[model samples]
Target: MTQTFDPPPPDVVLDPEREASLRTIGVISYALHAVVAIGALLPGVQASIVLLIVAVIVDLVKRDEAVGTWQATHFSWRLRSVLWCGILYVVTIPLWFLFVIPGWIAWCLISIWFLYRIVRGWLAMNDRRPMPR
Candidate 1:
């Protein structure tokens, strides 16, 4: 005997009001990240670090919808990217002490790498692919 498979019913989609709320939350989260990035350029490293930390926490908390899950996973990928960037920063610090140009160049490269990773992760999340093993 052959078995037949039935398709699942469509899920109830959120209304426009709920969709707008979710988008607003996402915008706020992105704005917080922008503030954190800008803080790095200001004087007082300690204060800037604190602001960045707060921004990260706020971003995490604001992500409470379906988009939030994607944002959280993207954030994790970015965190890993930052860890790799940190290793590069450590190795280049001594070089920076000797000559600033090469160190700055390395920093820029690492930053670009981190941004690229984040963008790729975001795109993958939007595509809804299974995480790689």
Candidate 2:
């Protein structure tokens, strides 16, 4: 007669302190992004580039630390959002020199999209859920 063996259980242990720290970092990053996004959407209200830079720096630095955790997706989502927004803005720069109205319109749409991404990500983070890939 042959005997059947059961597979081992997966590791489910987590460090509570580390998780709390990661969540706090996520909140700070989201807050900074929200401020920048709102400022961009508003008329004549310039958001400080310094804040964006700091948020980016925070995401880049702490991202690796959050690997294998749910928070990693948030870091990735924020970074991708910033990268895409910058690319879109640069691609539309010629519109500014060509047609003022169209350029303004393009930037407004992009700003709205950026704000949406920030809000969605922030909400997912608050709910402690991973962002949809």
Task: Show where candidate 1 strays beyond 4 Å.
Answer: 1-52, 55-75, 130-133
The C-alpha stretches of model 2 lying farther than 4 A from their native spots are: 1-12
Q: For residues 1-133, write the lDDT of model 1, one tens digit per residue.
A: 5533222135635567765664464445444444444343344532245544564575556544544232344444444554576688789898789998887787667656655654555455556432231
The lowest-lDDT stretch of 10 consecutive residues in candidate 1 is: 3-12
TM-score of every model versus the real structure: 0.50, 0.89
Model 1 TM-score relative to the real fold: 0.50
Candidate 2, residues 45-81, lDDT tens digits: the string is 9899899999999999999887767778899899999
Clashes of 1: 0
Question: Which model scores highest in lDDT?
Answer: 2
Supply the TM-score for candidate 2: 0.89
